[model samples]
Structure formats: structure tokens, C-alpha cells
Target: MTRLSAAFALALALALAACGGQPASEQGHADEHAAAGDHAEEAGGHSEEERHADGGGEHTDEQPSTTIPADVAERAGIEVQPVGPGTIADEHEVQGLLTPIEGRVAQVTARFPGPIHALRANVGDTVRAGQPLATIESNLSLSNYTVSSPIDGVVTARNASLGGLADEGAPLFEIADLSRLWVDLHIFGADAQHIRAGVPVTVTRMSDGKTVETVLERVLPGMATASQSTVARATIDNADGLWRPGSAVKARITVEQQPVELMVPLSALQTMNGEEVVFVRVGEAYQAQPVEVGQRDGQRVEILSGLNEGDQVVVEESYLIKADIEKEGASHEH
Candidate 1:
């Protein structure tokens, strides 16, 4: 009985040892699989990091810059001008109309009331002083008398026709000498206060933008009833007869001429990222230089900061550069 009991205990002990050894072997294989998986994960992480480094190498500069070839800039009509000193004329813009000088106009009238015998002039006809314009049959003398132009001018109106009755003191022909003209600029509200005689005025014809520089002749005593504006007069030469009377024009009255240390054309200014910028060129790249500006006039502006003398600034077609830079930035964001 004792031997049987001892044999049972020994068999049980052997069975327990065998079960524990099998579990240890299975655990060793599982640990090896886990280590291999960790190594593979580490290698994959290194590959991902390498790919990121390669992508970074291809990255562009985040600064506000545009690359434009010289040929491209020329083709785009982009004009670059060096920053320098210039005169910024403090000009006040006002609307105006061209008129014939009052002293140069003539009203040809019949000396005595009668029937027109012969009409020799028509509208747009050029005539000289004392040139016969028409012949009138005087009622008092019952004789034909010749009427003559008193001044050299172009006929602007012909009130008397052939065989028409003419009245004494009534204008029969209106003539004007167009060699010189008066630009009647109307200055409203505050602009009239700065206006005075002898100030330089630049008159631009609204039709074709033809400009003529002249001096302010005078300011009328009375305000214009229709516009409630002061009338500033300037004389412009019209020997070519291109500036017609009664044509609307724009006048830039330069009240002050100030020489600035650095100035650029108004076209050189552009807006980038909600700030005023001027594109400065260096080689093939244009960088947006934020600038603080001073006084500005009709054609030019004073540069207070962010620019140096002789810096080549893009004065024309700068918007094109701005567009290209923004497009590149957008593509990078995506």
C-alpha cells in the first residue's frame, strides 16, 4: 500500500514539471515575435523621417518674394525705377472748362438795318481782320454796303443768311481767335482758399488726356451761381486749335512745390498682407518691402521709410508679382 502511494506522488510531480516547461517555451517564441515587430516598426519610423527630410529640402522660402525672369518682366510691361529725390507738387485737383478769351471774341453786326445782299462767310471759315464777311443793302441809303470782320478769327456762327433781313446792332457773325484759351477752373469749398494768381496749373483735356501747363491768371471776384464755387482762370496756348471752347477739363493747381529727400511715383505703391508695400528688385527676385509713406500728390508720393536711394522699385505691373507669390503660398498650404 505504501509503495503505491509513493508512486502516485512521484507521477503527479513529473506531470506538473512537464506542464510548466511547455508554457516557458511558448512564452520564449512570443517574446521573439514581439522583438521582431519592434525592429520593423523602428525601421518604418526611420523611413518616414527620411521622407519628411526630403520633402523639407524641396520647401520654398516663406518670405514674401516673387521670382520673375528679366524677359518675363519686360514682357509684362513691368517698369522699374530707382528711388530718388523729386519734386512733389502739392496740387489741388478741380474741374474746369475751356473757354475763348473774352477779349479775343468778336460780334459782327450790321451798321444799319437792311436786307443782306451777299453772304461770303460760313461757320468754320478762317478770316482776317477787316476781311469782308457780307454785303448789306442799307435801308437809309438804299445802297449796298460791305460788312467786314474786325478781328482775325474763325467764324463760329452765321446768323445772317443769303437774302435775309439784317437789323442794326444785331450780331450777324460770331468770330473768335483761338490762338489762346482760358481754362475756367472751379474751386469748391476749401480748395479756393489755397488758390491764387500765378500758381502753376496743369490742364488736362478730358477727351484725350492732353496736358498743358500754364499759370493761374486770376480768380474771379464773384462765386459762380450755379456751382457756388470760385472761378480760377488760367490761360493755355491753343495755336493748334485743338483745345475747343466749352470742353470739360481737369486742372491740377500746384499750390506748393516741395523737394523731398526720397520719392516715388504713386504707381510704385501696392498693398500686401494688409500693409503698404513697394516691390524692390534684386537680381531676379522681387521682395515686398513694407513702407511708411509721407505726403502724396497726384503723380508722386514721399517715402518716409523702408527704402534706400537708388533702390529699383517696381513702379508698374507690380500686381502681377503679388499674384504669383500668393498663388505659390496657396499651393504650399494644400
Candidate 2:
């Protein structure tokens, strides 16, 4: 009986040992799983750090700078104008007409009541001073006298046809000298009061986009019935025949002018980050500098700050340089 009891106790001990071995093996596997999870978390943290670094590079990459070749600068008209004193004003644009200069229009009229016998000059015909334009038979003397142009110009108007009867003081032809012209602009209400003679005027031709410089010559009396505004006239030189009478134009008038110590071209100004900026030339590169602007004329702006008297500022095609710098930054980021 003793031997049997001892054998049973030994088998029971072996079974308990086998059960303890399974728990030890399970604990080892759990530890290995926990270690693997820790390693995966470390890898995820490294990836997040790399992503943050890449995001930070996006802003750091954008640097405002560009190099332009000499020929390219010339072609782009990227010339710099130094800050200097100039007349600055608040300008207003008005529609205008290019007309013959005052006292330059001529009318070929019959001296006495007569029957028109012949027509010599037509509209658009260039005629010299005293050149015959028409011939009419006088009613009193029954004799024909040639009506002539009074000035050298292209015929702009004709009131009679061939063999048409003409009364005394009747216009036969109208001639005007186009070499000198006047820009007639209209000003309304309070604008007429502000705009006076001697103010600068810039006339832009609507047909070919040509520009001419002139000044306000006169402010005529009352409002015209057709335009409902007072006429303001400025004399423009038309020696090149670029400006024609009766052609439409736009005129920029300086209503008020004041001298400024330091002024820059208006074209040099650009908006960046809600601030007015001007690109300053430094060797072969352009650096954008913020500026405080005051009075502004038609083409120039008063620079109150951020520029010196002799600092070179780009006056044209500055947008091209800004585009280049942005493009480079985008490419680098990609």
C-alpha cells in the first residue's frame, strides 16, 4: 500500500509541473509581443518627425530672389529710376475729343448770292491756302468767281454738290489744319471747379494707344447741352499726324499738384502681404522692399519711406522677376 501511495504522489507532482510550464511559455510570448509593439511605436514616431520636417521646409523654401540677364533686362524694359523730387497729384480720367486747334478752322463761303457752277474740292482733299475749292456765278453780275480755301488743310466738310445754288455767306467747304490739335475734355459738377488751366494732361489715343503730354488750356463757360458738362481744352501737337480731329481719346487730368521731395514711378509699386512694396535693384538681383506711399500723380507716387534719394527702383516689368522666384520655390518644394 505504501509503494502505491508514493507512486501516485509522484505522478500528481509531474502533472502540476507540466501545467506550470505552459504559463511560463505564455508569459514569454506576451513579453515578445509587448516588445514588438514598442518597436512599432518608435518607428511611427520617426515617420511623424520626418513629415513635420517636410512641412516646415515648404515655408522656408520660398525666398524672393531672381537673376536676370542683361539682354533680357533690356528686352523687358527693366530700367531703374532713382528716387527724386517730382510733381504729384490726384488725377482723374475723362473722355475727350481731338479737334482742330482754335482759330485753325476755315470755311469757304460764297461772297454774294449765286448759283454754284462747279465743285473743285471734295472732302478729304488736301488743299493749300487760297486754293480754289468751288466756282459760282454771281446773281448780280452774272459772273463766276472761284471760291478758295483760306488755309492749308484737308477738306473736312462740304455743304454743296455740283451745280448746287448757294446763298451769300453759305459755306461751300470747310478746312482745318490738323498739325495742331486740341483735346476737348468734359468736366462735371465739382470736378469743373477743381480742374483749372495749367494742370498737366495726358491724352491717350483710342485708335492706336499712343500717348501725348499737354496741359489744360482753358475751362469754357457753361455746360454743353449734349455732354451735360463744361468743356476743358488742352493743346496737343499733332505734327506726326497721329492725332486726328473728331477721334475719341481718354485724358488724365491732374486736378491738384504738389511737389514731393522723394517720388518713385507708380509702376514700381507692387502689393505684397497687404503692404505696398517696391523692388530695389541690388547688383544683378531685385529685392522687394516695403514702402509707405503718399500723394500720387498720373505716373509717379510720393515715397514717404523705405527708399533713399538715390536708391534704384525697378520701374517696369517687375512682375516677371516675382514670378521667377515663386516658380523656383515651387519646383524646389516639389
Candidate 3:
């Protein structure tokens, strides 16, 4: 009986050895895994090649165009604007204050140290060129010297009173024309780079948001001590007496500008995979189209290529378009 059992066990062991170590189901699973690995390697290589061809290389700045459904874009507040003839004024919005033009302001001062003999032009008094602001009895010369207004203006400040002592070049009164003024705008960093003489600027009063057109006269070569920003000076005609000096205001200084046949708002521009992109409406899908951008102002950007007149472009909240395109790509990879 023991020999018969031993023979049966030996026969079973020999049969298992003939079929290999694993069951048929297990063997099948192993074979399937190996096939899958080979297929994955093949697919990964193909995807890499496609990506490189489609401008997906690490140093490549061009991005492959993608698309999003029209309905989805609309729900995401992706506003579209038609590309057509428009003026793109490369402008910057900056804070400014109305200032009196230098030649229009007169700081009436005595040439020598003296005592004020008489005060003629008080604050709020209008005076003309050579009009006496005060008569000073000089301490050195001991003669009464007439300190007169150097320009036709109204006296805005009076520091010397009747019988007051005055030092040489001590301002007795300040006279300002107030007819012509300047918008002293402080622009920092890149905004100050292009600002120079002859650029058109618009000065808006901060009190009531009143706007007046003007041209930038010149940019101060030095920066302000307190603000650390360069000052851009624009001369504004104040003949109407509406614009006042020393008042806070806002200015739109056009730095660079060009008229273009087609343009889009700055908000419409998006960077995708190191390339500038804008979503354009096509049929029922919004195509994330790579674009060649040109002279861009503060508000709009010139579309040099990849778009045409009357083509609708996504202007607002375009990140949703980018996200949807990326999601679709990930799904296809799986």
C-alpha cells in the first residue's frame, strides 16, 4: 500500500513539472502583464515623438493649439471680442498732481538782507511783471530796494509782513500765473522707460474725474526722493480755471502706440507652454490659438498673426480655456 501511494505522488509531481510551476490562469496573467509593458513602452515612445513634433520640447516656445467646447467657454465667462481696426495706445495709468509751470511761478525775494518797509502785494492780490510786492530797507546798503513781481500772476503766498526782517533771497511772496499748469506724474520701473517728450497724455481730475487732453512736455531726469519714482511732466492749458495746481489727479501717458488692423484686449492674452495664446471662436469650439503679438498698450494688444479681422477672441477669464485643454490631453494619455 505504501509503495502504491509513493508511486501516485511521484506521478502527480512529474505531471506538474511537465506543465511548468504556475497554474494556467496565473500564467495567462503574467503573459498579459508582459505584453502590456511592451505596449506601454511603444506608446510612450510614440507620444514623445508626437510631442516634439508639436512643439512640446523643453526649449520650444511654441505650444500646440487646443480646443474647448463653445458652451463650456461661455459658462466660464470667457468673453469674446471681434478683432478689427483699432488704435492701441501703449499707455500707462499713473497717479499725478497738478503743478504750476516753472516760468509761471515767481518767488519774490530780496537781493540783499533787509527789513520790510512796506507790503504792496498781499496773498490773493493780482500783480504784473515788475509790480512791487514789498519795499525793503537794505541792512548793508541802507537804501530801500523794491522787490517786484517777476511775472504776471496772483500772489499765492506771503511770508513777509509789514516791518518784518528779510534775509537775502528770502522769499517774501509767491506769485503763480495759474493759467497754465503741469500734471506731475510719477511713473516707476518699466513705465518710466518709454515716457519722454511729445507723447500724448490725458490728465483726469481725481476730485470729479474730469478729463483734459494734453501732451507730455518732458520727463524729469531724476527720481523723486520720497516716492522713488521718475516724474513725467505734462503741460495742460488751464485757461478755463477748472484745472488747479497742487491737486491730486490721474494721467494716461501713452508710451508706445500704433494703429493696427486687428487687436485684442490685454486680458485676452494668455501664456500657454511658453507661447502667447488666445482663444478664438470656431464653429461650436473655442480654439486655443497661438498668436504673434505686437505693440501692446495698457488696454489692448496688437494681433500681428494667427487671427483675422472680425474673428472673435476670448477676452475675459481665459484660464478656463487653458485648464480644459490640459484636462483633455491628460485623458487621451490614459
Candidate 4:
């Protein structure tokens, strides 16, 4: 063969080989891309499963809670108490007044008609029994005689004057022993039927909310003319002389006492998500727990469900925890 012919043939062979190799390289790159896509699909599916298993998926309705540091809780005045059994007093409330006991009042008067010579005791003077209150010259005896106090008490009234003609059996001084008093409570309607002698009663001072416990001494047979309500009486000691007559008071008559299984203070209850809940402490986190309630008294309520014994329940300032959780939810929404 000629030399130029041989060179042309070699160049043609080389060009054909190069074209074939280019197609193979393009196919290899395509296979690599397909393999990368399969690996990427597998990795994406695994990642999605991991998110669901780890509880980072599209689930809502998680239990609401808030994390508060111990110092912050103290500063917020949040208090916690364990729930346990207690008593619910089935009590009826009524209004009443403190009155001096009957038969303890004495009205002093002149034993005999005379002209008053000298008056010694005046209104508001404390006197002992048989103490001389006035001196007078009796018209019949034509001599000086002393008019004495008949009882030991504070002189509530004095109607006599010096040198005045003393009238017989006319009230000169009114004395009353106020060491003990009677609580006159007015009970009405069906409540009167539940109350009777020997039941327990709690008398509270309306002015200061001070309370004293006593038993019903008697229920007067007739109704009070002013209110037509049944009159119930209980004796109370006033040794300190703090209780005064004519002061309005509140009374609670315990008709029955019911024993309950679990109880919590009414202050422990809070409203969250339109339901009554109590903040329960777990570690540094407080969670709201819904509860079923039953019979209740003024200070406490019966917890029927959603609580176990020894649960540390927030008893004071629980609303602070509720507000914290609500604020957190609002921020998340924003």
C-alpha cells in the first residue's frame, strides 16, 4: 500500500475509536447520576421515618407544661402541696347577732320612796354587788338610807339626780353582766328543719372574720317577729370583752359531716383551655391536669379523679403557671 493511504486509514480508525469511547463515557456518567438519585431517595425516606419516630412529626395536642426555675417559682409566690383525704362540712350559713344572756341584767330602783340626798355612782361606772349607789333620807323613816347596786356589772344607765324625789320601783340604774353572751342566729325555710339543739355552730364576726365554735343551746319555739325566721341560740364566752352586742355576725350550722377520699384547696383550681385544671409539679416542669370535682366546702373541694395520692399540686398562685403556658403557646403561634 502507498504511505499516504496507510496514514489515512490509521487516522480514520483512531477517529472511529474515539467516537465509540465518548458514548461509553457518557453512559457511565448517566449510571453514576442514577445511582446518586437512588441513594438520595433512600436517605430522604429514612430521614422522614426518623422524624416520625422521634416525635417531631405533625402531631398536635401535646400535654401543656411550663418549665420554671426553682428561684423563679419562689419569686412568683407559687406554692405546692400534696393532695390527700379531708372532711367536707355540710354546713348551713345564717346571720346572727351577739346578745347579753337573759337573767343577767338587773334594773336598780329605790326600795322605798324618799328624797335623794347624794348620788355616788354614774353611768359606765363598774360596781360590785351591794355597793352603795345613792344615799337618801326616807320620808317614812325621816333618816338617811343608802340605795345600793343589786348586781356586779357596769352601770348601763343612771336616771336619778341629787336632791330629786326618789320614786318607788322606778329604774334608777341598769346593770348588766357581759362576761358571757348568746349568739342569736336566724335560720329560715328548710334550713331550720335541719338545725336542732346539740348541733355544732360556728359564729363569725362580720367585721373581722373571727370565728368561734359552739353548740346550739336551743331553738326558740316561736319565730322572730321581725324576720319570721326560726331563732336558734348558742352560748359563747366573752372573757376578753371583745364581742359586742348589736354587731352583725355570720354563723355556720353544721348539719352533717361527709368524709371524702381526696381533697384540695379551692385556691388550687385554675381555668385552662376552658376546663378546670390544677398545676401538678414534676421536676422543674409544671403540667396542667384536668380534674373531676364533687362535694365542696368554703375552703376545700373534693377531687374525684385525675389525681393520685401524694401528687404535688399547686395550692397558691397557680394562675401564674397557667399564664406562663398560655404565653408560650401564643409565641409559638406567632
* TM-score, one value per model: 0.79, 0.67, 0.49, 0.78
Output the lDDT of residue 203, model 1: 92
Top-lDDT structure, candidate number? 1
Question: Candidate 2's error at 41, in angstroms?
Answer: 37
Question: In candidate 1, which residue pairs get closer than 3 Å at backbone N, Cα or C atoms, i.e. clash?
Answer: none
Could you tell me how far off, in angstroms, the CA of residue 334 lies in candidate 3 after the best superposition?
39
Ranking by lDDT: 1, 4, 2, 3
lDDT of 2 at 172: 78
lDDT of 2 at 322: 59
The global C-alpha lDDT for each of the candidates, from Candidate 1 onward, is: 0.82, 0.76, 0.76, 0.80
Clashes of each: 0, 0, 0, 0
Which 10-residue span in candidate 1 carries the lowest summed lDDT?
54-63
User: What's the ranking of the predictions by TM-score, best on top?
Assistant: 1, 4, 2, 3
| Root mean square deviation (Cα) for candidate 3 | 19.6
Report the Cα lDDT for candidate 4.
0.80
Clashing pairs in 4: none
Candidate 3 lDDT over 218-291, as tens digits, reads 88999999999999888888877788778999888877667788888988888877898888766545667788
Worst 10 residues of 2 by lDDT: 55-64
Candidate 4 residues 57-126, lDDT tens each?
1111245776565655665567899999989888888999888888988998887889999988988788
Determine the backbone clash count of candidate 4. 0
